[model samples]
Target chain A: MKTARVIYEDGKHKWIALVRDPNRPDYLIDSNEYLVIDDDDSLLLDPGGNEVFPAVFSALSTEFDPRKITKLFASHQDPDIISSLALWLEFNPQVKCYISWLWASFVPHFGGNKETFISIPDGGMDIMIGSQRLQAIPAHYLHSSGNFHLYDPKAKILFSGDVGAALLPPGEDDLFFEDFDRHIRHAEGFHRRWMGSDKAKRDWCQRVSQLDIEMMCPQHGAIYRGDQVRRFIDWFSHLEVGIVKG
Target chain B: MATVTQDTGRELRRIVRTNEEIKRVVATAFKINLMAMNAIFLAKRAGQTALGFGVLSNELRRFAMDLQKQMSQLREMTYGSVNTVTALVKQARLNRVLERARKESSGSGRSLIDEFMRTRHNLVFARHREQIAALNRRLSQMIADTAQLVELGSVLARSAKIEAAYGGAFSTSLMQVSSDFERTIGEIQRSLESLTKHQDATL
Candidate 1:
């Protein structure tokens, strides 16, 4: 049987959670927190953006222990992503919170206790869990104040924040895209509305292109696979760098 | 002109989506500035404000106003002329013809406008430098005044013969306030330098 896709619907909690930089509208960004259960160590990616004590906590409790949550990962230091970090750390004292080096000060700024943080500057860390290895490819500040993307190389799963995540229609709840065009529209609308720096996003797309992606786990919208990710990147590459282009 | 049109068109395209983005950032920064100014005012009203040099609150109030007056002069220089990035870009583009002339001609040391702009820029920089230096001087005077005020307050606090031991206490307190005020000024200067640099770069 296919693995269960545990989802935490943002509903209205996702406002300008990912706002395109005022200077650039083509690059989509905003801090997003997601967790993936990959058989071994429960990998939490960008965990502090949304209030996790209830939604994310209940979602993750299905597979693992909140106390056994050894790894807490984040892309950057925006409050949505890092503010509620203290709340996350309260459940597990041993959870080694990880964030990008560029926003190390950002953690402390959010009252994240200095003792619990581990700095990871660049991407490409083959961090091994029980059996699966997560290849964290660096996705820098494209739209948010600070940002990154985490990928599970083995599962071909890309945990991309604010990338392809779009507001689902009234009653729809499918995370995976069946049609490529539909997914592109969902992704593009958000990107155009809340993008960051085009140059930075172009660099990010180029960097992640090396990875063989199958499923994209975006923070806001549904997931995409294979060629759709490339298509999104292509369309995104043409958008304005800092300002919105009509 | 065609190239300019193309570039401007590209910039206009970039502007559309950034409407939301720009508004939000500008709003946030404005909010922070307002908050900081309000906090400063609230502290002053509460009488919880600490002077740079241990001066009485009223004297320091005057000092702050004086410093503000001096800082306003800085704005005159900053927004006086087109010293922004857009202006610089336009200048560079216009200077291309003059640059070619300099390369081809035997006697093309500098054009009249070139010399004139250079002099004008020097004047701007000189004015800015004076204002910055004058601000620092005013702060120094403020600290001195504060120190004297603190010493006077301390003397009033003492009883009997306020002559012998008071001198020693006054000297120490004076030094402390003066040093603290100077350090505060240094920090202010550093913050201003960085903010001004960012303003210039972004513009």
Candidate 2:
């Protein structure tokens, strides 16, 4: 059974990530689900779609009793990112999902009522988990038109959603990338095709570079920790995204 | 699949009912202590003539006290089991809902379909099922202990009856108290036996 692994923790605050299931079928793209626990409340980020609900739900149960999850954050309206909205809402209707105001109406088509969402304006907003504040940084058109990345100032950990994701090869199932140069090859093709604009990628890299981030976490592949955080930013800054290369 | 869910729901309800029954047994156990205390006082009134009966009454009082402590432990365990069952029921319901949704869905929404099937194979329900199994094991052990308590009470009751025969002026009253203790213990034994059997089938 897939269990939650605590990726980061300090006192009452902790970041738990449910890793990709090894037995997951070849056709489906692997995704990671994260739980940010602060005191008594927890916020689930990019909790994945309905298909992975049982796994996600089961992984979450290991760390949290069902009621501990008070909120959810969807990076964009991707089915892989938030399609499990309806299933999660079923488990916890009171859980408020944070998403861009643009997808406020569109994402609910997946599964949400008027009261279920907390719409972040174009500039983005600060979300409170218990007493701790987490900033939602805008990543518009990196892929989705109105996407966001979560930043925890206390942990200096940035949950970049699909921003740093890599499609890892089989047998190399490590959680954190030990070598950044080797890891970028897996992420390069995904960023080129999926990220909609070079301008958006530049804007995101420039903005995130200024933050003192220790670890850059992606939804799909291994995390970039320590100096690799800077290496990823520098590499993404020069990369030509959204272009059809021969 | 629906049948499995229905059976699970029914089993959860049965667990809840069993917890309530165990609570009632604990209350009856409290009453047994009261009866044992009264028997102690009746023996005291017969003075030196009922000294042997008095000794047996003291032993009965200690037995009742020990049984009460064990019953409290059993009640605590039962309450914990109820909570575990409630968690299992929640997981079971989610699984049933996901299965139904998967069948009803189709099309270019291939990711969504994959997600439903993915969740079905995930470890969440399996973990809860494991927890529920552990709870059943603890409950079985608790019920087994209650059975042992009943056997000990029966032996003590027989000893009290033999002592009551030598109680002189308080002989009749002492004999009556011993018989009452024996009957109460029998009722407790029957209730615990029924509980164990009920739990056995569910486990």
Runs in model 2 with CA error above 4 Å?
B2-203
Cα error of candidate 2 at position A236, Å: 0.3
What is the Cα-based lDDT of residue A104 in candidate 1?
A: 73
True contacts kept of each: 0.00, 0.03
lDDT of 2 by residue, B69-150 (tens): 8888877877776776676665566566566444433332234545644665465656666777787888888889878977
Q: What lDDT tens digits, residue by residue, belong to model 2 across residues A28-128? A: 88898889999998899998876677667666665776556769999999999998887777556687999999999998887678998899997889999
DockQ of each: 0.01, 0.02
lDDT of 2: 0.82
Candidate 1 lDDT over residue span B1-203, tens digit each = 24543543443333222233323323333333333343334334434222322223234344444444444443333332213323433333433433332332222223432453365446533464454345434433433443344334233223111221222434443344433333444444444444334333323
Model 2 error, position A120 (Å): 0.6
Q: Model 1 residue A100 lDDT? A: 74
